[model samples]
Target: MAKRRKMNYASPSTNKIPVIFSIAVILIGLLVVMSSLKKFTHTPDQGAIEENVQMKNEEFINRLVPVAKELHQAHGILPSIIIGQAILESDWGSSELSAKYNNLFGIKSFSPNDDSIKLKTKEFKDGKWIEINANFKVYASWEDCMRDHTLLFVNGVDWDPYLYQGVLLASDYKTAANALQAAGYATDPDYASKIISVIEKNELYQYDK
Candidate 1:
């Protein structure tokens, strides 16, 4: 007679442990991969971002071309210089002064008879930026605002070169930008550079022709 050997089997729960652990590990790895992909898609490339801004600025400049040409005809100031100044001072005609008062040049009000609006503004003084409440001249139309800006450069009805000689005598956009700084057009020390940057970046000199 042969003795039968006793048979033993492992419990089902213990058998399933390896399978459950592998499933859990795979789920965790999938989650990590998904998270990485999400970040990559959301991140913006610097070059693309800058290109978008340039496109927007170009669109804004194109929209104002007609007015710039009109100003060029009325006054000898280069359309490029005027448009660059407008973009710098008024933020592409989107500033509070431009939006509400049509004040594109940030010119202070000296004429009491002219319609005006009071607004908070920053001025560079004593080598510091100072907040001040200023009265800015308001124009009934954008053309009027552009005309006023031209008058500031030429001054009086005579078209005398003596008043704003630095501006009127400028031979080109670059010279005009530099002249504006020399003539104290803005309080900022880098005002000319800022305007020049805008003009060059957009190739505004083409408008001078």
Candidate 2:
């Protein structure tokens, strides 16, 4: 092969056996690194606590979501409006009546001629809950109240959306809330403020966006 090329080679400090040992050492190091990462990431208690909080929030959201979604579907009103209304009316489930009666909106109805149905209600007279017999429309369930709310918007002859759209075209949440109040949605002077409070406090508007 013409003057054959000379090849020179030198053995490392260790032979193939040492190479095997080095490979084993590398594998062990890699395993240790992986294990450390696993340990760092394994926060079972934290995960469980976070999950519980999420579940509670989900339950609260579920309780309020139907009202918001219903109004959104029927009137194109932001679900936030409904959520806010519930909060203001129900006091975030802290109201004594809300806990017992589930009447979040405090809607009223009584036979004009007869005092057949009377219910206990709270009034802010001198800042106290007064057990007075008030005329209120009782429902079979809370769901009925939300349904009725939507229907009022659609069925009210003079105050229906068809009639009021032009009036509320520039409607912000505050304007719409005030418009509803002016249309006799509620008697309370602070009605709109209450709805706005609930929506903002719970961040209920997130449901829409």
Candidate 3:
């Protein structure tokens, strides 16, 4: 009779292969779940953000209307345009520059003699927005800022005395808006439309009267 060959016993490590594979699969699944959760957590709640901004805008307008009326009466600058510009440039007086320095018009300092606050700002230049550090005039209060803005139109900047004549000559808010764009009050191509929209939406023309 032929002698039976002894069967080789399988190693214990080989028996554990299924267990290792199951652990790896579980770990991979957990990683995928964690990645999905991370993405969900980082997504912004756009509606909530927008609602907060709107509430702030309303509050700013309320606080501004009386002060703006008084300034306009004194300066003869169109209140509608002033309010619109303040809303646009200051983000309803909530921007850092406006809140801290009372710079509502984004006017840059043209002379070394001018007292200034240095800050990072964005400009619409050569068909794109560019970042730069600029010297902006500082003010003791929002009233001072309003007064200075009106004076800027009447007196012009030291560098260009005739810079604001177009805006100064305009007969109405719409005309003033267009003239400001022509005078390069802002570099945005749609600056006139944006100003006009703000004026109309808030019935800002009433303040002009």
Candidate 4:
């Protein structure tokens, strides 16, 4: 019989090389998958968060424009002023006083029998901010709150019937905003500036027309 050629077989250690290589490839694949998952689960960046906030604010303003324009037509109050005060006082309708109770203008209730809720509010006093609990008016709806707001400007308080008449007489939002501060609509010294800033920043004057 002819002698058979010697068969060359892989050594066990050599065989393990392929197995090790396969394991390393699988591990690399797993690492890649984990990295992809990490990227997918990341939270929104500051810019994205800010964009969402801006969008929500725009939505709030748009929703109020129709009613504000109507109020302006019925009363002489500037639409820009109404919308600006709504945005500032209610925090775009996110404040608990406005969101739950529909008291958009922070109108207070002096009578215990009135429909109201007690809440903490900040007041500017003695050149410092102080928190106090007070009774805030409640309304059936946002529309009612807005109507009451306009009536307050038109009718004024018990002490003075023409208190906010200056606001209604203002030709522009700036003057109206200042008139609000002058009439003591809010305790904050910079209330007028804040309203003006909100109006200008959002181009709320467009609604005046």
Best candidate, TM-score: 4
lDDT of each: 0.84, 0.65, 0.85, 0.93
Candidate 4: misplaced stretches above 4 Å? 1-33
Name model 2 segments beyond 4 Å from true: 1-58, 94-96, 112-117, 122-132, 157-171
What local lDDT does model 2 show for residue 34?
Answer: 96
Error of 3 at 147 (Å): 0.6
Misplaced by over 4 Å in model 3 are: 1-55
The reply for model 1, stretches above 4 Å from the true place, is 1-55, 156-161
What are the per-residue Cα lDDT tens digits for candidate 4 across 6-77?
999999999999999999999999999999999879789999999999999989888888888898999988
Per-residue CA lDDT of model 1 for 1-209, tens digit only, reads: 99999999989999999999999999999999999999778767999999988898778788677888887777778888888998998998889999788888898886689689889999899899999998999988766888788888877334444556676677698788888888777899889899999998878899989
What TM-score would every model get versus the actual structure? 0.71, 0.55, 0.70, 0.82
The residue-by-residue lDDT of candidate 3 on 120-181, one tens digit each, is 98889988999989899987877788778878888876779878877766768999999889
lDDT of 2 by residue, 1-209 (tens): 68988997866654678789989999999999999899779667988998987776567568779766766766766667666776677666566555665566776664575322466765645555456677766556667667765565555544355543421342356666766766766556676677676667677767765
lDDT for 203 (candidate 3): 88
Displacement of the residue 98 alpha carbon in candidate 4, Å: 1.4
Residue pairs with backbone atoms closer than 3 Å in model 3 (clashes): none
Q: Sorted by TM-score, highest first, which candidate order results?
A: 4, 1, 3, 2
